[model samples]
Target: MMNINEHLLRTFEARPGEFLSGEELSATLQVSRTAIWKHIERLRQEGYEFEAVSRKGYRLVAKPDKLDVEAVLGRLHTRVLGRSIHYMNEVDSTNNVARELVQQGAQEGTLVVAEQQLAGRGRLGRKWHSPKGKGLWMTLILKPRIPLHFTPQLTLLVAVALCRSLRQITSLPIGIKWPNDLLIDGKKISGILLESSAEEENLNYVVAGVGIGVNLLPDDYPDDELRAKATSLAIEAGHTMDRSEILVAFLQELESLYDIYHEQGFGPIKLLWEALSVSLNRPVTCQTPKGLAEGTSLGIDESGALIVKLQDGTVTKWYSGDIQFSS
Candidate 1:
């Protein structure tokens, strides 16, 4: 059964630029006129603009610039991704919360989201700036029945889904760096961090932490260093976008691609990812835990490791590293 708010939204969407009278809504929703009025008032408080006349009732003129569980679910059309949501006004990290929930037997497609992350972190323990309600700071808990080694491919899968989703919203040239850093105009715009646990050969759960800078401006950065390296969707598009719509599109694309990954394999996803890659066939160096290796990137192998052909006619695969490009 649909909720009253969702019903109201559908009614407004079904008949755009047309007034819905109180008697009509009351009869259609099987509720009192007072109930309809209350729901409309709540939507208005959430930044919905309504044109209310004496007897002409309400008409939706605008929507909120926010992304919450309700907003995402309102527009979501997916099978697995984003089926369950844990929304927070503020939290330390969505990934931490997602891991905790998965340990408690949370189902796949469970999403942990926050308006602000006090302890948000990217790969290599780098701090990720998550201001209040300025970006999509969320983590998805997935339980793919694959080996621990194959789990790295999910990061690449997420990069492809993210790139496709962002392309749907803006005309910016979005590309992926090795391992899954989303870049636009050669500047970082998003990052994906995957954490997982396994017992022997059996696989456990994987928490995918995703952070996308949406509505932030260059001045929002704390210092010039970050401003020079980071850019947001709003900064590139010259307008603020609806985070809810973007999240819904991302979930839909992710679900479709994830199903394809399970049925067919990683070949298709790898092709798509490589097509959007920026580091492939480029001169780069990986700073690993042992040391640094400089070579020309040969894209990725089957297991999603960074493949680099060194100058001395040797090839190496880097599982985890800080990649630096030396054009």
Candidate 2:
């Protein structure tokens, strides 16, 4: 069966800045005029604005500022990432949805994106601020053949991609915090979370959840603590940004990095990651399951572990935990 809504959207997309009559759309869609009208209504409910005339048909005048499925899909030049997408206006979490889809045999490179997340979560299961149409929230599924223990590497890889995207689109100073937090001048701008579904000793699939503050304003972060540390591209750039552009940019960079990772190895990716890292060569505090330690980040290793030089001149490799810069 044809997806009447998606096809209808494509028709308008092809003829941008133009209007079509009901008869023309009906003839093109091979459906009744009523069906075309219904489809247009559906698009409107999805944040699309149509200018309907008395005799002439509808024209797409405006689109949502967030990541529209058709818009993102059309703009992507990637081969593996973002080929398949499941879009929702609002959801509990894209990661949760992607996991369910994975169980139902969703292929690798499948993406689940939303305009808003009702119960979004960040690292340590903390609440993630995902305002409607104010940021980008999505989860991408991958089924790499790497070991399950190496899944953490994907997080850093994504951070590199995201940081590259921001750098390309804006002039603000952008860098990656250890692991996968993206910061613009020491303020948080983005986060990445990786969840994998694996068998006893093998990996089945990995869900890389990404959340970015694209066009968020100061009003969005009313919390005093959040306002001090959290920021958006718009806030830092002093202008509004299109979330769709950032969405496509991130996907393209991620696809390229993923290819490099598969074709060569993690060495190249580690180097790229180190180049964009803000924690390296700086005083840092690490909190691991074992205990807390202060050190200077030397960079990551081939296996994606943090190499830190402790205060006592002792060197150690941290395999797991979170690290925060002292300064």
Whole-model lDDT values for every prediction = 0.90, 0.88
Model 2, TM vs. native:
0.81
Task: State the lDDT of candidate 2 residue by residue for 232-261, as single tens digits.
Answer: 999889999877788889899999999888
Could you list the CA RMSD of all candidates, in the order they appear?
6.2, 4.8
Q: List candidate 1 segments past 4 Å from native.
A: 1-65
Report the lDDT of model 2 for residue 207. Answer: 94
Worst 10 residues of 1 by lDDT: 63-72
* Model 1, TM vs. native: 0.80
Clashing pairs in 2: none
Q: Estimate each model's TM-score.
A: 0.80, 0.81
**How many steric clashes between backbone atoms does each model show?**
0, 0
